[model samples]
Target: MSAALGLLAVIVLTAATGYFVAQEFAYVAADRAALEQAAARGDASARRAAKVIGRLSFMLSGAQLGITMTTLVVGFIAKPALAGLIQPLLDAAGIPEGATGAIALAAGFVLATLIQMLLGELFPKNLALARAESLARALASSTLVYLTVAGPLIRLFDRAATRLLRTVGVEPVEELHSGATLEELGDIIGKSQSSGHLPADLSGLLDRALSFGDLTADEVMVPRPQVSTLPSTAPAADLVALIRETGHSAYPVYDGEVDDVIGVAGVREVADDALDPATPVGRIARPALLVPGSQPLYGVIERMRESGEEFACVVDEYGGLAGILTFEDVAEELVGEIADETDAREDAPTTGPDGSWLVDAGMRIDEVVRLTGLDLPEGDAYDTLGGLVMAELRRLPCPGDRLTVALDGASGHGEPDGASGHAELEVVSVARRVAEKIRIRTAAAPAPADRPEISDPPCAAPRPEEASWTR
Candidate 1:
């Protein structure tokens, strides 16, 4: 009867141990962001869990105390009770009385430990970690009750631990953390994308949003050459033509040159008044936002928002008009392309005959590499395909110029599977003294560069001043 009573007590203690173990693991692994999101959506359980997670150090100490105490009590009761049950079996197996008791006791200890370690520790811990958020919500209320009962002892232990740490020159404080680091979050997104839990487009957007802080205005801006501008002293007819040709809502009004500009004129604002052919373009211009090219995109966006201006002229180190960026550009960096009715897709890449691709020189090198499935080369010295070709030719590229180069690498969109190939790049058109349209002819597979050739004698390397802004 006593042994049976002792066994019941041991089972109860083991259950308590399991509770604490589960509570510890669940909260440790729980996604706090998910909890907060749930709370925002009016989940009562999630709110309670968030509270406990907020005071993680205290809650954790309570869990540890409960686990330790329950384990100790279970061990004390289990050995004697289990030994009593084992002794008779040992004797019936013809073991001698003196040796039988000792062996029975040892066996009892091993059995109790195995049962406790498996049922009380490992099982619940695994269960909690696998379903962390759900388990945390379920356990939070009960844990709070436990902490209320054992608050004094938990605090005492925590204080002692803090003092011990201070003695060793370490400051002890509550170690509660709520969110994953950027790198960890990125890794999670990558894994989710690979496992098909997240769509590729959504994953890419999320990754870009997280990385927006690292981008500079220069990286996302439209270079100066791509922007249309009108001389501030020009007639209103010029403004009308500029808007009609570029299909832009706004254009910079420069005094003499693009660098000596005054302000931006919106077509709608300019058109609001009666059209006078002789009206100076500067008469309708609004103040243009000037920002440094090196400014981080986040700060640029904030500055634009605070100033109530969407268009900014990005200036380089020497204060030259480096480029222009709009709110749409920064937004596109976060959420991918924001297409509109006015967007000209005619210049976009297209499929050509015989495994050839029609590409735009304005396309980013990384993007071109992705689309062509050919290992087009790249270096930090250039960013656009046009720039790369120009650097190689060492001169102004003209229509009909062709170059045969070995394909070596591809990146960003994960194309070509790191294969090598040879490609013929034929210039189809030139605009603004740069290659505007390029035809890329790709072979089926990677091959060694055997017969390198070029058509039209290449020019000498351009002067730094000429290539700096042109390419």
Candidate 2:
């Protein structure tokens, strides 16, 4: 073939290679959910794109075949053409008798490979990934036609691959996997946070949001001991006093025992002119909204919303009050802590003189993880640093209580890495049998200097508490 026609063929073949590369990546990276959404909206191109993704393995095989065939053809056409065109140039420069052909061939091969890789591979691949949804839709029809023509060959190749995979105990699926599990997403978020690809606060919020649905009322409630309640027969003045002292608007009024919660009373119930101080508190209380401790937070929120209750009384299996779950508790689960004017600034975690963190023992375990970059173990039995401490100690904590736990990874955000370290948790204060405040110091963390360390702490059996906290 003439050098001019050969070069044109080379250009067309390289373009074809680019088309397959773009199609392959675009379909792979395109958001499956987004494509479905568009298809639902009557976008014909997106409808076709969605179909392509349904047969991912076959589509990908066809794309690979196109890329390989076109790439080889481009090399076959371009090399000899390039050599013929360059030989005259080499001859004109040096009038070489033997060296011109060799020099021309080497130069032509380099030029063809560069053109094919840059234009046919890297550039298209990046563009396809960045604008995957749009390109996937744009090329869907053309890709379908190509695949239809190549179906027999592609199917044969795919069946062979499936056989090989099955022989090794690997099963091939039709579609590429999409969404990740929460644990996998957490690992990604952690790496992004550490690499500064995501800001710490936003990353943390996202991590919480992803895992929020998996939380239950039991995991995010005020423990029964920490919950303040009133007897059904308590005087109106008693209810008023508890409300004012705790700065909480609502109180659960129980019958005989805290477990037998009868109804809830709010400050609004205290404004009655007809009521006397000596009147029974239950007389003004509204019907309490009760929920199971094991209910998921989303279901809890739905129940609360439908019932028009700002809080729910979570009950254990035997129909006893376990804890009170408020909307604020749900909000805090996503946005970390929420403080109002009533909250004491002193109660917030602060740096000690020796660099230890003086934190509330009731602080959530996730918050503690973010603070110290230590991988303290987590289990269904506890969700707070205080709970973890109590679990490790096997008993409620007391003043100057200390325990050292091994770390799984220094990157507090992600999956456990092989990197090793440890953290020391010291109970700084106990109030009414609860570990109300503690000091935390961990190796490789910025907050605290070294503290006395206790290793693999032995836990004691949980004991009944003489409680103190309200709200």
Best by lDDT: 2
Q: Which segments of model 1 are wrong by more than 4 Å?
A: 1-6, 29-48, 96-102, 130-138, 167-169, 269-273, 306-308, 338-343, 347-361, 364-457, 460-471
Give the per-residue Cα lDDT of candidate 1 at 355: 51
TM-score of each: 0.76, 0.75
lDDT, residue 257, candidate 2: 83
lDDT string, candidate 1, 358-448, tens digits? 7767776645664565658877767778887777776778666677667665433344432445677776677767887777776555434
Model 2 Cα lDDT, one tens digit per residue, 320-405: 99999999999998998788876654444445556566677777776677765556778678888888888877765656667776
C-alpha lDDT of residue 267 in model 1: 74
Model 2 spans with C-alpha error above 4 angstroms: 1-11, 30-58, 72-119, 126-141, 148-171, 184-201, 317-319, 345-348, 411-420, 444-471
* Per-model CA lDDT versus the true structure: 0.79, 0.82
lDDT of 1 at 439: 70
